[model samples]
Target: MLPTATGRIERLTLPETDQTVCGRIALVFPRTPVAAAENPPAQDLVRVGEVRRICGAQLRNWGLERFDDSVRLLLSELVTNAIQHGSGSQVGVRLSHTPVEVRIEVRSGPVNTLTARDPGLLDEDGRGLLLVDALADAWGVDDAGWVWCVIATAAHGA
Candidate 1:
């Protein structure tokens, strides 16, 4: 099934204007938070809480609250995909906040074989990107051999 969706990203000014913030990651790890961790988040799941907490912090963060659920959900999927599909080193989670939009970049070395999930109607096997595809305004893969997703702050979640 074709699962790609089209959405709007703010104008990307050229000539040297691909705005971005690149974060380097290592064999990092995070302990599952007491109540919030749905699964045993990978070793490098530290960014999950940081991103989640930052999404609901103060005014600026509170604004993220609107998009927080899908943001966090997509974030976890990207991270898990990296760990499961990319080399088991570390994954990079970059939250790009521009004047007109917000985007997430997850960078990781790819695996020799990729395993896509099977979202059975009643089976909770693989429904990662399905959620991302359905919720995010736009989501896709990138050149760095990583997965990226973008959603409008206003689009949030149910």
Candidate 2:
């Protein structure tokens, strides 16, 4: 966890604003253990605020700012999937920023499946992979039950 903000919390500005374009919220599904095996994954949920904080910090530290909301949405979706689909509650989230790419990983517990009908255009649920496919440069699930996706700055740099 990040050190608690000591004084006045800082607010950040987006690079630019245009509805047609999403700034880009990227994620990397964590693989290593987030905590001890005896704990539940929910105990280690990656909160939205935390994700935003982490992403923003990484971007700024890497000399950038204002990630697209798609990054946040996908992070929440994939992390939620890890907790909802997997057994462990101590899920992990990692973010990396390179001049040409951003990668996210979330590792929860082993799972049973990763495929199903994509959510309908207006359905309330079941569209994680579909959303990832639509927004991410590419995404897929692994045999070990981990899921991940990467959205590059321009294309295949990730």
Candidate 3:
């Protein structure tokens, strides 16, 4: 659990994982904080915001701020699905990047059946993976329920 800005204690459970990406490590955090978990209606948005804050900082620290907006959107969609449909108690987010690409992985359980379905123009839902597909250079879900994506970067020669 972590203390919030208001000094209230928030429940956050981050179970450790041994997974690593391209020699970079994985960071874990709870899918939802105390208030978000208790409040179902606002759970996904609030929790995704919290996760975005963490991810934004990581990108800034890595000198990859150029990808922030896309990463944030991708994180929101991916994490939302993880919280809504995943079977795990916590969600794991991992970020790693090389000179030419940045990778993101969101894992919730040992298994997930995520697929992008075609949605009508007026449909109100089912566009998450489609957005991921459009923004990410490459993306796929692994057997261990990890939805990962890679975005090409122009940092190669920088």
The local distance difference test score of each candidate is 0.51, 0.56, 0.70
- Candidate 2 per-residue lDDT, tens place, 107-158, comes to 5666655664656789877777777778878677667655777777755432
> Distance (Å) between predicted and true CA of 126, model 3?
0.5
The C-alpha RMSD in Å for every predicted model, in order, reads: 10.9, 10.0, 5.8
Tell me the tens digit of each residue's lDDT in model 1 across 1-158: 11112221112222424554221122223223322225544443555555444433421443445555666777777766654545433444556554445677665554333344667799864787777777778777665565667776433331
Candidate 3 or 2, higher TM-score: 3
Q: lDDT by residue for model 3 over 1-158, one digit each (tens)? A: 12233321133443444343332435554554333344334644576787787778878888888889998999888888777766665667777776677888887776556679899999987899999999999999887668999888854342
Q: TM-scores across all candidates?
A: 0.58, 0.59, 0.73
Q: Which stretches of candidate 2 lie over 4 Å from their true place?
A: 1-46, 120-122, 156-158
Model 2: what TM-score?
A: 0.59
User: Relative to the unseen true structure, what is the C-alpha lDDT of residue 66 in candidate 2, on a scale of 0 to 100?
Assistant: 47
> Per lDDT, what order, best first?
3, 2, 1
**Which model scores highest in lDDT?**
3
